[model samples]
Target: MKGFARRQRSVLGVADALRLGFLGLKARPGRSVLSALGISLGIAAAVAVLGISASSEADLLAQLGAAGNLLTVGAGQTMTGTPAPLPSTAAAMIRQIPPVQSVTATAYIDGASVRRTAEVPAIHTGGISVVAAEIGLPKTLDARLESGTFLTEATIHYPAVVLGAVAANVLGINAPGPGILVYVGHEYFTVVGILQPVTIAPEIDQSALIGFPMAESAFNPALQPTQVYLRSAADEVPAVSRVLPFTANPAHPETVRLKHPSDVLEARAKARTQFTGLFLGLGAVAVLVGSVGIANTMVIAVLERRREIGLRRALGARRSHVAAQFMIEAIVLSLIGGACGVLFGGVATLAYAAVTHQQTVVPAVAPLAGIAAALAAGSIAGIYPAYRAARLEPSEALRSGE
Candidate 1:
């Protein structure tokens, strides 16, 4: 009894157990690689999905940061469902608000149509609206000109037009230069500028802009402001929005409609978050499948290595030692797969971000969480197999091998 106790105490050291674990994996290199591949693929999928979503969200936030404080005011429909027009003084009224930084307004021309040339049929109006715009519109909206120049004070009274990004494409006009003309309201108006796509103001991207003075002279002298755009200090946006409708229309504040462009963008970001959750669930399913594969592989390994188990038991190795060896092997295999998965996932994220022209943003916790998940999967998968190997009596295992 004393000698048996001494042998049990001498069992297997950590280093020796680790060595045996590695040796077992090396003995069946092909099986080991396949098992690890399963884990790697699952981890990679999870990491890549999270990384890509994060990058996309970061890009959206950056755009919002540029123009999130911009707000739009328009008149709501009257009791008869006819659209109410904003008062001509609405922009001036909004500018009086202490929090308002800048204000500009545009009035849509009812019967005006714009085309590449007068020869084009008026029936093919290309879904584009003609709008009379203020000279300060580009500054108020923080909009960028893609080509040529925006409407200037000097050009406001002339037959000059500025095309929105989509309007330019629809009109087949790439850039504004000398002799570049668009037929507007049955007359030739020189194309003076083309704007870049406005993320915060998509409606502006689809309209053709003409100076207010030009629109009054050529299209309608009685044009009233239809849409009023304003920017406020970032921290004062909410307060400004609350009082904007009242300020824009003091007589009928309820008929004044206010829209936060940033809210629309934020809603889109939230929708993306919901999609990210769905994708994460898919990733989890893949990981579950990989864990099952590892469990199945380990069970088969235990069955195939009965002779080795019996020999080790006969040499006075404790059952706990044998169990620990299998556990370690499973964990090591998963760790290797996890490292590779992180590398592959990170590379995929960077490539996608670069192609999409977005800033890359991977959460620091992603790789760490992946590795932890892999380790946990390994622990769970090794349990039943380790138990089965440890339970075999030395004599019974030897006989089974024979």
Candidate 2:
């Protein structure tokens, strides 16, 4: 009997194992809390990083959505390095594209100065620009009218002018009405409308827009488009961009420069991953520190509880039972920390999003992955101490503790 192996013991049930595990932690409340804090901090860092990244990416994507499928085309230089102006009919050519929903172009009128009145010194020109604008500009730029109506077909040949937000302020034209005029190109143009703001083209916000007909007939007949703005189906943006050069300038397609502003937003959204990797590295370090803390705490616990281990061993408890008890206690401790960390991280992400005016976003896998990592860390840390505790000889342990 002395030389034979002991029969294997049965494992504890789930509920009973958890009960014993909870009691073991309760016996050392102070040390248990300190151990769990390390785990909580690690999990919190990981979860917060994920949540904040998702939120910021969501904000950028939302802005892209607002931009729609807008594209800007400008004149490019020739092989000789001389700058070129976009064709006068560039907007009309772009409109021929089937997917093109709206198209507008603007040409700067040179040698023009806008003043509140003729009495104002020429040097006092308010830095306002005079541009030839299409009637469809409001739709193309998705601009809002703050005062009177935009240039219409009947008003295109007349001296009607529309003021951007900044231009209106400088010209002392708060509201558009009859008898209100601003001196431009040695002529007085009646202010017909004031625009709120233009997001796609912020330069438009500082300039005065006049109808193309008025610009050609009175201001400058040879004026050509300096910039073109257009919108097409989202799926057709690439196709439209490819052919825009040929369509705008058949003889010299190379003299056109096209840009998709939405592509810039998409690039920014993808760039979020760069920061995510850095944040995740920080989180990994935190988790590593937590794992070390757990391992240290468990080793100390095993040393301090040798007598308890011996008494249980003397009372017919198997070696496996001792190991199971300590291992379960470690898992429970880590779980408690993981849960608290999830709550803390979620609140922090939401609060930050609200302050920054970004949409709150949290990936579904974040919490599950966090908890699983905690469980894995806890299990690995429990192994050495659990085996050491189970290896003690009952009589020798009891004698050594005396």
Give stretches of model 1 more than 4 Å off. Answer: 1-10, 117-121, 171-174, 179-181
The residue-by-residue lDDT of candidate 1 on 1-402, one tens digit each, is 665654345468888988988898899899888888878887888788889999999988887897678999987887788787888899999999998999999999998888888899987789889999999999988899999999998999999989999999999999999799998988998899999998888888889999998898887888899999999999999999899888888877888888988888889999999998898788777777877888888899999999889998998878998889888888888777778888888988999999998888888888998899889888888898899999988999999999
Local accuracy of candidate 2 as per-residue lDDT tens digits, 193-283 = 9999675576888898898888999967788998899999999988988999999888899989988777777777677888888888887
TM-score of each: 0.89, 0.74
Deviation of model 1 at 152, angstroms: 1.7
lDDT of 1 at 121: 92
Candidate 2: the clashing residue pairs are none
- The best candidate by lDDT is 1
Query: Which ten contiguous residues of candidate 2 have the minimum total lDDT?
Result: 59-68
